[model samples]
Target: MTGGPRTEPIDARAVLGRCRDAVAPALRAAVARLDPASREQATYHLGWTELDGRPGAGGGKAVRPALALISAAAAGAPIAAGLPGAVAVELVHNFSLLHDDLMDGDTERRHRRTVWAQWGAAAAILTGDALLALAHEVLLEAGSPDAAEAARLLAATVRELIRGQAEDVAFEQRDDVTVSECLAMAAGKTGSLLATSAAVGSILAGGPAGLTAALHGYGAELGMAFQLVDDLLGIWGDPAVTGKPVLSDLRSRKMSLPVTYAVHHGGAAGRELARWLAAPGPAGEVTDEPQLRRIAALVEDGGGRDWAAAEARRRMALAEKALAGAELPDRPRAELVALGRYLVDREF
Candidate 1:
């Protein structure tokens, strides 16, 4: 007998919502311990409150934490066992975001002014530091048997994240970015934390080492796919959906994967694009909107967009393969598959 269609759609929204609900209390409690100014900035950055501190509806998709929780459940542990890891991963993720926004000079996020833009750079930096410290504090206080190891893993991941950010900043000033270098930077910047997020749940639950390794691999692949999609969005996504200016990455001349691929692979078109990018201003900055648009079109004509999209699908497949290798319970395994699908398949 022939098998039917093997994959089914998952309710990503519901899964993320449930994970957010489960982890929100602990996250809030951690933030509540911050001093008043830091607390307000942190809470606003997390979408827990408006600029004035009233409750608001802005929040992220909760994908990283959901991966932690779902991975824990897949390991045959209670969902509560994953809570500390989930919250810790979310905190670390946001810590990076706050710093990244400042470093990238981004003024907006989630359709609102960024923490740095709204509360000033010092407040944003301090609040980010508070979040990072609090992640460790909360993990250590969880009293899990593996709490120490979890804390160590998160600390190492943070160091790797900083390295990635540093490389990204350095790449902006250079014109000789190889695709391999770009991928390595993406793995460091985006993949390391996600790998930790996936493995932490299993580690905290004291799951088998093999299972934890498998989940880490899965999460890394998923993270690569996620970043590739982000690169696509930076070029072509709707401002309303992405909550940023149109073609913001191009305008800033960010060396996103698609742009990198185009610059390397587009032949004559690539050369033309490079000339425009090299047309720096008095301060060595490229900020002309008309030129930015031309570079975007050149990237498209050179097949950067198609290559990045294809690469995203390839990474998603790798993630699915890694998930298949893990010995998860059927329900949670299916959910993980669904989550992987949702991550790469999103428009925003």
Candidate 2:
């Protein structure tokens, strides 16, 4: 938040870039296999191309794929052994993104128009579905001895993901949502896939069960930290940095972790916030800048902001703890710890 980027023991950006470079070729090839329309949409969504088919300079952190590759390395396998799983994980991540952008009615991402905004809801849905299907295809064709089990794991994770998304949507309409329920939803939506990402590669490489399970636990806790930071950014992150409008989560009256905690425990401020949330008429997007600022302030005053940050730190510690007791290769194990720190501390 202060310096441009944090670089100490490890340059996380450098590490992430390397992972992206390793994963990009196969990811591109898989995207190329989509039908023309879905291909265009997928490429655009992935920041590989512009809306009009030209090259673009936008892309995500590639954290999930990175986790998969590192998980393979941590298991003492060649990183190449993780390629198919990494590609599958990345595809699934984007599938969720396309659908999330559509469902959230977000008009932009990565400083560009969202798929649903540029294309259409139907296009977004179908393209997302194509990606989901392709993820399974990639895994099954991987030829790894553990491919079937990995695919099954992915399928189960997807179910948890949808369950989380459904809970997220349901929370917006109800004012009585609990903090524990919010944590559970965050786990389902974010933790499930991340756990898969961290351990699927180990599964692919036939790693021992103990290490694989440890990596999975690491990912799950890291996911919680990741989502908490994201929620904070949704309310307080610079639009220029986050590629989103200010207070985007509060705008939609989203019952994010911070807001839910504030409403559940903020005393007078929480009561005031609850009234605003439950006001008459559908809780639509709030665009007034001053009002948005006040709501963000109320969330802070109600302890949502501090609570979220503390919880993130707590989760990060737990994630790192999962690695400490495991018999993991030094390099990837350390990298995994670096990656988890970046997730909670990242500015974008």
Candidate 3:
């Protein structure tokens, strides 16, 4: 779909960079309360310090915090008004990542060793717990007029995030995963936090209820689209750009969207895939390269990749619609729309 009129193109990278710059100081201060050991681990995980406590330059895309700040701006408040909520969502995101690395047995993230891999699972788990607690602490201490309400909202979102993650882990063992179930899991695991990021921003800004709801809807759709793209990348993304091994999801036997679709809707190819998945082997040992290539080809032949791409586009359209409906100024709304497009449009 064609976006709104534009004088110049919206630069999503620049916007995200600004958000990172604004939130980094607050994030560092919040995590500083931990003991030196925990602090070092946490900082390292955040891409601010090396494993040996030296400076480093690796980190996530900072998308959630940018969503928070932009949502606040859409609600007619200055971006700084959402700093507390931005920091809160970002901390929660990283906390989930730390634990996820342990749970998924993933060794690398953003081209660096995972916290669990670097310092042992115990250190990773404790530092993650510290970050989760610090997220709330930062919110409460932000002195926002609606801090109490924002905290309550964030608490509920955390519960949803846990529930989603639990479902994801459980799905790995079951063979009967459905597309609908996978969508629900995505909502819980990914959508909930994103929706909360937008909602918390609007709440902190004291934006109108309708506008808050619209932003929440925007975030939910964006989160689903984001996860769908991630699923696609897991199979076909360039290793150099994505910083993950090729066919990483298939190797791990994850029930991601494309795999689920292929398994359920791919007819003969689908059955072959099921058989391969059921083949007994050592845990976490993916099929060899030749077999893995066959699996990837089977998935593509089954229409799984095309289906997921279509769904991503559909969700992104809904996200843009939600942003357009919000009672935001023209420029911020356009930027938000541009951000939604960029999210689903990325290759890595």
Candidate 4:
């Protein structure tokens, strides 16, 4: 799927499905704790129910929850032992998605109207708040020996995620954003949560500190690799596969990894890219396909594309290296490594 799996690939769908099936009931019960209105919106957001409130299709790839369950297995525990971590991470993921949709003015997601688009921004905000609170509740109420420490970790991760989102918003107004700064934002926004996902199950399983730490390292590096590929797709992916138009990130002038590299590092073409980006975009977003293609070409010509692709592979290697010292069973370890490779090479 991606560049190529470094190890024989596990079926991504099956792994995700195993985790999703294990976590779904508990996740539903947790969402049921919210007020009726919030619960309704949350259910819809999760894709468990349609807008009219009937049973609907399933949700996302469940990647964070899968990592949570798999980490438990790596720690020599039953996957069910990871339920709290799995449910908490899934709630947190949806919480971020709810808030992000509104903040980014996104109207559609997964081929449906977003929470804010269908129910108003206030409703979206409230629903997101409820989900974030419920994430903590799930961890605190899990009653495991490590519940306290896991909750604390989740708290820290949430703070970093919010800080990253804040930085992303702040970047829109400034032109001097450095590549390092953008990377820092990405670590907080994306890496922190994935790190928590990979480590929290080990915590719940009462695994050794060294094992937990190693898992966190793997997740953190993999998160960076995943984000780089996502940025590439935001610019060049087929809309049919990606479920978004090509150059989506470029049009919004998002300071993605590649764009930032191109802006600061590409000599002449980079300078030209800067000028084009600085020009007031049509309605604050470049809509013309011809112009969008030109901007994408400039990003490639300026070396952003090549640099991002290389960095993604580098990060994936780092992810595998992070597990080198841990004495995990061959299968679980190989699966983790393969997941990172899949993210790097997937077209969408």
Instruction: Indicate which candidate wins on lDDT.
Output: 2
- Which ranges in model 2 have alpha carbons more than 4 Å from their true place? 1-8, 281-283
Q: How do the residues 234-307 of candidate 3 rate in per-residue lDDT, one tens digit apiece?
A: 99998887887888888887888998999999999988888887778677669587888899888888888999
Candidate 2 collision pairs: none
Q: How close is candidate 4 to the true structure, as a TM-score?
A: 0.96
Cα-based lDDT at residue 148, candidate 2 = 99
Predicted structure 2: lDDT? 0.90
Q: Which pairs clash in model 3? A: none
lDDT by residue (113-211, candidate 4, tens digit) is 899999999999999999999999999888889999999999999999999999999998888899999999999889999999999988999989999
Model 4: how large is the Cα RMSD against the reference? 2.7
lDDT of 1 by residue, 1-348 (tens): 012114556687778788889988988888899889888888888888887668888589888888889878978998888888999999999999999999888788888789999878998899899899989998888788988998999999999899899999999889898899999999999999989988888888988889889889989999999999999998899887887678888877788898888889999988887776676745633567777678888999878999999999999888878877768777677777788788788783
Model 3: residue 136 alpha-carbon error in angstroms: 0.7
Better candidate by TM-score, 2 or 4: 4
**So what's the TM-score on candidate 1?**
0.94
